[model samples]
Target: MKIIKFGGSSLTDAISYHRVKDILLREKEDKVLVLSAMQGITKKLQKAIRTALKDEDEVECIIKEITKKHQIVATQAIRDTEILSDILERIEKKMKRLERLLYGINYTEEVTAKSRDMILSFGERLSVHIMEGIFRAEGIKSRAMEADEIGIITDGEFGNATADLKHTRKNLKKTIGQELDRGVIPVVTGFFGQSKDGYTTLFGFGGSDYTAGIIAYSLDSNVVEVWKDVDGFMSADPKLVSQAHFIDRLSYAEAAELAYFGAKILHPRIVQPLEPKGIPIVIKNAYNPDRTGTVIEKEGYQREDVIKSVAYTRDIGVIKIEGVGVGCKPGVLSFMASTVSEHGINIKSVITAQTSINFIVDMEDLEECYKLLRKKHSSAVEEVVKMEDEALIGIVGEGMSVTRGLAARVFSAIAEEHVNVDMISYGASKVAFYLIVKGKYIERAVKAIHKEFFKV
Candidate 1:
């Protein structure tokens, strides 16, 4: 059996839903479907949450708009009017529940983590309901199931909860088995899971992929196919480097590195559960189903390609702590790390010299990191330098670690383009090489490096 996952883009509207139904109907293999919230639904939910927190009256309007859009999709996609009515009725009940939740938040004047999670879950709930109706109307045996119904229990981390797999596997096998035995396609909602205490929790932003991976591992399925907007993984962002092309295959490690650095094709954590089980992941285009997409496997493509892809991220900020004895001060680095950890800010990359330590972080966390440093460690640090508008460029491949002069060639390529790298790091796993550069020079740097290795 195979586990198939559809992203938000694949279920954006009635047209996209029709395309997805056709895609699934064409496949003959016994498969289970995983689905994300429809495109724009999650964002709309979030907007309503924000408005509710401020006690704004506009929250009701947003909620109505969201319900109207979903109602339209169901009406247009499902040909049977009775099925559409049933879906709309169910959606109305769910929307009322959401309104009540938002009203509670407005009355309390606070949006707690638990409340926020509950609000976000409506996206998947409504999406699965509509899709299940569409599938049944199209003469396919299908049923909608929540993540909790399949026993995807997670920790109480609210926004980015981690799954308890041992418990999850035990419960999932039984429930999913029962569905399969009944000859019904179980359509599971992605992203949110129930905690042990019954509170709603999400895996993260693009967590639906992670959800699919977990389900795949639990079921011990042969493969997990992720349907998205694009064909597959690309050598570079085509918007940044027009010459970038699709890569046919990648190792689990290479794919993780690319996603972590800025490849938007897959979420970084999606490969964690699949890697240990040696499960292969295939990325395909939902619109153009016939196109061959990228595949990620345990035994990666046995090719001599030293560099599989180049990925880059802009809006990185650098913090430099420099003092006469800062590097030698044993507790300085430890203190910095602990303080940052306390604030839940992740340091993307760190570079150290004889007298200074540089912490690279996302721009969203830059201000808080700086504020914390100034408040706690002003005395230990002599000078704190802030560098904004920086970008991180990463080159990923399994061969880079074993290959010699790859670093030299990469630097040569960037230097030829007159790009100055602020700091560099070779990932400990040897799957990727990352460098920090000015944001303004990121496009030129990526294009130059792509041309150097790919010669495109």
Candidate 2:
């Protein structure tokens, strides 16, 4: 059996829905289908939540728009009048519930972490019904199952919850196993799961990929197939370097690094659950299924180039703490790190020196980190600097640690572009190294590095 997941881009409109149906019909193995919301629907739902706190009328308008969008897709995708009507009715019921939830937020003038997660979950919840209805219209036995209903329990962390694997595995095997035995395809909702206390909890944005991984791990499937609009992982972003070509395969570590450093094709945490089971992830294009996409496994082929991809992200900032002996002081770094983490700010990388320590974090969290550090250790700290316009560029491949001259080549490429490197972090991970540069030079630096490694 295989676990197949369709991203939002693959299920955008009526034509896209039909394409997904055809893809599933061609699959021969007993499978479970995991789906994300239609393209742009989640964003609209997020907008509705925010609008709920300010303008109730605008929230209602957005709700209507969301309903109309799904209704149109349902009408076009399901040929049987009965299936179409049933799907439409289900959509209406979900919309009414969504409206009520948003109104609750409006009346209270607050959007707590719990309510926000509930608001975000409506996207996947709605899409699964449409997909299940389409499959049924084609005479395929299918059931629309939400993650919670199928017993996907999480740690209850609200915005970014982790699944309780032992409990989830036992529950999924019992619940979904019965459905599989009956030859029924369980079209499950992705992206969010129910907490221990029965609250809706999400796995962070673009977490549907993580959801697919969790389901694959729980069921002990042979492979996890992620169907998206792109062909596969590339040497670089095609928009940045038009010559960026497809990467046929990658190691689990290399793929995880690329995803974390802004690959965007897969979620950063998707590899975690699957790693324990040694499950391979195949990224295939839903629109062009005939093309072989990138495959990520435990051990990948060694490329002569010594670099698989140049991944870059502009959403980074550095917080530097300066003192006489900041690095030498044992509790200084720990104190600062714990303080920032307590407020839910994630520090991506930490570099230190005798006199200073630097913490790389998300750009949105830079100001808060600065204020937190300043307020806690004002007397002991000399200066707290926040560099918000920094971009992180990473060169990822399994052979990087053993290879020689690769760093020279990368630095030479950046030098050729006349881009100054603000800081560098290496040797922590065998598969990847990182470079921080000014945000203005990010494009130039990425293009230069891609040209050097890929010879484009």
Q: Count the backbone clashes (under 3 Å) in each candidate.
A: 0, 0
Give TM per candidate: 0.95, 0.96
- Tell me how far candidate 1 lies from the true structure as C-alpha RMSD in angstroms: 1.8
Any runs in candidate 2 off by more than 4 Å, and if so which?
A: none
The CA lDDT at 78 in model 2 is 91
Q: Per-residue lDDT tens digits of candidate 1, residues 1-456? A: 788999898888899988887888887877889999999889989889888888668778977899999999999888898888888999999999999999998899988888999999999999999889999897888999999767998987878888888899889899987888888888899998999999889998889999999998898999999999999999899998888888999899888889888888898888988988999999999878999999999876434658989998886899898887787778898888789977768787778776888899989889889888877773558887788989999899886778888888989999999999888987476678899999999999999999998998
> Which candidate's TM-score is highest?
2
lDDT of 2 by residue, 1-456 (tens): 889999898988989988988888788998999999999989998888888999988877998899999999999889899988999999999999999999999999998888999989999999999998998998989999999888999999988899999999999998888999999999999999998899989998889989888989988899999999898999999999999999999999999999989998999789989999899999999979999999999887678898989999998999999999888877888888999988878899999999989999988889999999988973457999888889999999888889999989999998999999999988999999999999999999999999998899
Q: Evaluated with lDDT, which candidate comes out highest?
A: 2
lDDT of 1: 0.87
lDDT of each: 0.87, 0.91
